[model samples]
Target: MRFIINILCCILAFSSCTEIKKYHSIHAGPKPIAVVIERNPGIRVTGSETPLSVLYENGTLIYSEQSEADIPFYMKKELEPEDFKILKNEICMTEKFKKLRNSYNLCPNILGSTTVEIYMSDGKNSKAVSVYGYGIELEKIHDRIPYPDKNDKLPDEFRRIFRKLTGLNFIEAEKWTPDYIEIMIWPYGNAPEKSANWPSGWPSLSHPLTRKRGDSYSLYMPGLEKNDLNDFLDNLKPKQAVLINGDKWSVDCRFVFPGEPLWMKAFNKMQ
Candidate 1:
């Protein structure tokens, strides 16, 4: 009789443990420490688009632009937990939403697609949504997920949420431009070393060389106008020939415009 009672008690304990596990799984909420929104500004004549990125983390908001010039300028502001409540609610980072998003197929042939990525506090879990065209599809999916109909315009709710989070109206391109322009120069392939004596006709601007790799260098030229940049490029002549370790080498100039902070950070780490 006592053996039967012990067996029944063990079964009851196992069932209770299973129920507790299920309850916690269903009630778990998203604990997001940081959120990043990134998108291209649009196609340019140069066949390159500048990227706009907004990062919210540690109660601070940072807006970064890498369009007009090489170095990106960051504008930062302090934020409170309340500032993110609306965005968090709108993101709806739950297991069900993630499953639906993963199953949904993003529309192809999209012109100027935007990628919105969210990162949780643990940094292991993340969710991403692709916005095609003007984000009509994104709105539709958000409005009627599990079965959404396509639309032409972005949802008003999404626009409001983004504007509040980034403090910029994305609808207007003119508003995205900052007052200052930044320029960066990267020299590769047996580039000439800096001269100890300044050139006679050299432009009086700060050109600090940041090493990129073995025998390569990057220079940062900040706060310059269009005319100033044009003049500098016109006067700067490519090295005709270079002698490295008794071998004749010719240098080529290639400009790299990093569209995202990730690339920029990687470049900064070189050397």
Candidate 2:
């Protein structure tokens, strides 16, 4: 009787393992209809850094940046179905990607500079992964694998999957420029002793005075010319704002430009 019981236990264990394998194979297959990648470069002393968002859905791709009001300035393009199919296949074949853990913090602190969040859905099932810092080192450390290079941006498998999915190399999308630029300025650490002075070299405006809302101020500058925007960006000094805050705090400034989705809403509001 004891010998028979041992045989039954082994069979049950084997059956359970097989079921687990089958479950992963079915759920991990190519099924994502939409993917969104949000990249945050983190804060820098210069305060000139901006976050980026890339969205892929139904063969359409969009790259965007966020404004102060949480509006997005975007550039969009259409993609081929074949290319998307290739990306889906690559992702499904990655062993580590079978069912990503809900969350991962490769490095809790220290040398982290960027955070990437990936969201995917197939109109039925969905998965999300938040990668903190460069993924290469984190993935290795998490899996107890030796790191060949500390500076590697991502694991080989992930790099390939992202390259195919994002189409970073194949982007031939048209650039989108805004008709007018909106600027928002606010205190970062401490309230300013007095009103902050506008940077010099900015185009003179009939209403250059900033409008106060709560503790922050906003300025609207009208210029659609590419060169004009470039000049404004070049002259704007984030470091100066940091100094104005007693060198202890940084100024929060957001530059808003026109783009899809939000662009239409902004235009309608103007009209």
Candidate 3:
């Protein structure tokens, strides 16, 4: 009887210890990333009531994506790609909004086409469906080139902005490529505008809001959806006043020292 009692005591102690250590393992559960999509404002179209299905490499149910249709109130004339230009190929969701840092798991495979389909309707009379193209080989943010600055070093401006915007800090810019570092920034809150940390300039000639700086560097902002960016910024009130890479009206701090309070908590957690 005494032996059995002693064993029970040890089991109880172990259970108690595990309960106490649960908080330390918060990052263990379902550390997954999501692929979010939004209705295109330029199309003046709304989404269907039924949730859309997402397929992986060939035919695998990854996630059920559903979105309500949102069309512009103004009249949209039948415009060709060259008439009233627009960016039809843009991702609504990014990896920055998740707890897990490994987004490649949910993204396209090493070399394959990732399909994103949506059911959209104008709610009034026109109801149509469109399937967007998503391929892992393209839209890669990992390509890295020399910093525009003479030092040939990566810029830390984005790291500082990450701290200010999401209270998250990543590896040094020198260590990460523009593709490896996923960033989403907003110039103002509740405004329909936000930009990602893309290495290449927005596809110009198609996207008017984008500007090409030099042979190597390009600036892309206007082509991005404004409302989506604004909503993200509005949620993080603590990061108000923080700028991502700076604005045209202001000098870019890409070449400056640490400007914001780098969040060591996230860095330590990630490591």
Top candidate (TM-score): 2
Of 2 and 3, the candidate ranking higher by TM-score: 2
Better structure of 2 and 3 per lDDT? 2
- Residue 224, model 1, lDDT: 31
Q: Where in model 3 is the C-alpha error above 4 Å?
A: 1-51, 65-182, 186-235, 238-241, 245-271
Q: Which residue window of length 10 is worst by lDDT in model 3?
A: 252-261
Q: Model 2 off-target regions past 4 Å?
A: 1-53, 63-76, 81-98, 108-113, 124-126, 135-160, 178-182, 188-229, 237-271
Report the lDDT tens digits of candidate 1 across residue range 177-232: 22223332222345464312222332223232222334343223333343454454
lDDT of 2 at 82: 90
lDDT of 3 by residue, 1-271 (tens): 9999999999999976764453223212211111222223232112211112111111112222112554211111222353212211111122222222211222222233332222111112211112222222222432342223332221132222222222212222121111111122223433333433322342322343222333222223321344443454355434233333443111111100010011112122322
TM-score of each: 0.36, 0.44, 0.18
Q: Tell me which of candidates 1 and 2 scores higher on TM-score.
A: 2
- How much is 208 displaced in model 2, in angstroms? 17
Residue by residue across 155-191, what tens digits does model 2's lDDT show? 4445455544444433476555534444555555543
Instruction: Arrange candidates, best TM-score first.
Output: 2, 1, 3
